[model samples]
Target chain A: MDPYPPSNELGATLGRIRGLVLTQETAQHAVDLLAQVAQETMPNASGAGVSLIHEAQRTSVGATDALVRTADDLQYDLGEGPCLTAWATRSPVMIEDTTTDQRFSRWSGAAAEAGVRSCFSVPLLRGRDSLGAMKVYSTVPGAFDEADRARLTSLSVAASALLGHVQTSETSTRISSELRESLRSRDLVGIAKGILMQREGLTEAEALAALTARARSTGIPFGQLTADIVNGHGASGRRGAP
Target chain B: MIGFPHAEEQRALINAAVVESGFTVGEVWLHYFSLSGEVDEYEVEAYLTGLMPLPSLECDLLALAVNELIDDLPPRRRAPFSDELIRSHAGSGDAE
Candidate 1:
């Protein structure tokens, strides 16, 4: 039997960590570029925005103008808007006229007051997962045509393929915690090895070997076993089994 | 790869246990690294696959890492006896 079978979870986790390391700056750059693409695709759009959301919270955002920023921020702040709905539903959302729209009443009212009369939002979907959403805002009602919608949808597909590999802040936080735990466990093992070395007059290799032997015999987890040794509950002086 | 007496046997036994324990090479290597096992993850993978050989000491450490991870795995759910369940909830709010 192959001792080390292929581990998809480990590979994916490592890939995410590698992505985080490689794309901390690039992720923001990519979003900014995608927002520019959205604006370029629809020249009539007053402004454009792109957001990478995690668990209903925006992790990264890019906007073509202040109007776009305001419109996108209001969605997160009010917890309802075209972009969020597109992301949640994993589909496109169009507001021909925010003033006449009743779906997201609070958002539409506020958006209209903020000078956003129309919007088109498309979810950035990669396979079964929705990464976030991209949107274009227009100051005039019914500004976008069917062709414009189709163009934006195509852009979203390309954007999703790129952004899907980018790591979010959430992943960085998780990696740090995992590293901290690994360090803590390593420290305990070091201390346990030192104790065994001092008490048994053994070299480092022999000390580790002894610890491994003890763990195997007791069927105890190495971390817990080391903690026991460090805390003076180990079989130090006693040679035979308790 | 060095040839010591029973080196292949030791490697085989360690590989068997690691495979049986269902641990990825990365997980085992991380724990082994924590225990001061001096081998990189790639070499460890190679060693486990029998493509390369590790020193006897490193082999033992790998075995320990696998066994510890196996020990740490959450055990199967066990049905509690009626008396055990009662005793667990018998404290009520007294401790608080």
Candidate 2:
């Protein structure tokens, strides 16, 4: 049955899951929680997995059952399957008839050989952008009903929110690094300009103009010129020599 | 003729699979897989002819397509070739 919005019984479980999610900080831990939700709700399901995809490639972060692990591995290795489609399209993929499905026609045989019959995938998206996917596999046909789909969609939403936060954190880190580097470069640039003014008896603007001219003439970078000055310059302020 | 397996995976076959399923083609498709190793086409055809009861144009085409797929398979796995391949020149391979 689909477990959406949670009845009292499921509400308690959802509460527990939500509490646990609040307790963790790492993206990997969030992925594990998504897998746990899929596996717990779908008892007949053989495996549950979570994946992070960016630029068309997928990396699995967590797996709940051996079957799910295998499915995730196959998707990673094959690069085409329900989970791949879900992640790429940022939509839910329900493979009710795995055996007859042409998508399965390729991996279906191998997956069948490995004991999986049905698969359902929901994208973990960051508002129209798919950051990852959550997937569940079963040994029975039509195992994912409407209720299950709804339950998974909500869980996927929760996962998407967390994953979006993680991706944002990563972006913040990159921005901070660039800002630090920019600040450092400006500090060094100031010193180099000060050196130019002191040695050439020029104002700040004149020193900057001289440095720019030298940089252009020698085909050396301004940063390189400043570094050379810092390391005790040569006659032309080139990198090598005193 | 001279490319990776991904060259084949994105084949018109993807659309064909979507169109063929639950329609003209039956559920069970028997492929004569000859991995350039043990099995041969002649032996596979002989086996199919002997075992199957139905005889029609649809069956013939199915048999040919299956055999063609089997022939297309490399000595190695198909998934990696499909997965590992990228657009050689971001659109060059398809254009060529």
DockQ per candidate, 2 decimals: 0.30, 0.01
Q: CA lDDT of A3 in candidate 1? A: 40
Best by lDDT: 1
Best by TM-score: 1
Instruction: Residues A84-103, candidate 2: write the lDDT tens digits.
Output: 89988877998886777786
Give the chain B TM-score for each candidate: 0.73, 0.24
Which stretches of model 2 miss by more than 4 angstroms?
A1-25, A170-242, B1-96
Local distance difference test, candidate 1: 0.82
lDDT of 1 by residue, B1-96 (tens): 378888888888878888887887877887787676788788998898889988777887887777777778989799999998678878674453
Q: Is the docking of candidate 1 incorrect, acceptable, medium or high quality?
A: acceptable
Residue-level lDDT for A62 in candidate 2: 81
